[model samples]
Target: MRRQHLAEEIEEIFRCSGGTYGSPKVFIELVRRGRRVSVNTVAKVMAELRPAGRKVRRRRSLTRPGRRPAPRISSAGTSPPRNRNSSGQAT
Candidate 1:
């Protein structure tokens, strides 16, 4: 059985954060509100409460886009040039 009151509080905080806060954040919020709960316990509670609510947003690229497009590799199915002698004959 869950601690009904703590679970309710966790749910409230999680909902307030638009379901973006994971265990760490939820735990921090709970501590901020004077709740003496461990982070691991909060994580366990969250895991049970809303398994699908934790959505990891994609990380944005730190570097800016290049001015020029990237150089494309030739896929012409051509092999590397053969080794040639000084007279241009295949060695």
Candidate 2:
């Protein structure tokens, strides 16, 4: 009866926050509205609702390795010394 009403209100709050508000924020909102609710209860309700937030995309690497293998420096001094370009490619 009363529990069902509280669950509905929690669901509403979760939805109103663009589905980004987790249990802590939801619990705070409920408390601010003079609702006496436990954090655990809010967490439980949120788990049941399963509202999803936006997924964070990982930043792409700007300096990926080139297809060419790096030229090895020879200790035997057989090969002529090579100048390296800004991209670490042998010139």
- Scored by lDDT, the top model is 1
TM-scores of the candidates are: 0.57, 0.56
Cα lDDT of candidate 1 equals: 0.83
Residue-by-residue lDDT tens digits, candidate 1, 22-84: 888888898999989898888888778864355677999877787666899997988888999
The TM-score measured for candidate 1 stands at 0.57
Estimate the overall C-alpha local distance difference test score of candidate 2: 0.82
Residue 61, model 1: Cα distance from true site in angstroms: 4.7
Best by TM-score: 1
What ranges in model 1 sit over 4 Å off? 51-91
lDDT of 2 at 74: 67
Give the lDDT of residue 56 in candidate 1. 76
Q: Which 10 consecutive positions of candidate 2 have the poorest summed lDDT?
A: 48-57
Once fitted onto the true fold, the runs of candidate 2 whose alpha carbons sit more than 4 angstroms away are 54-91
Alpha-carbon lDDT, every model: 0.83, 0.82
TM-score, candidate 2, is 0.56
Question: Distance (Å) between predicted and true CA of 34, model 2?
Answer: 0.5
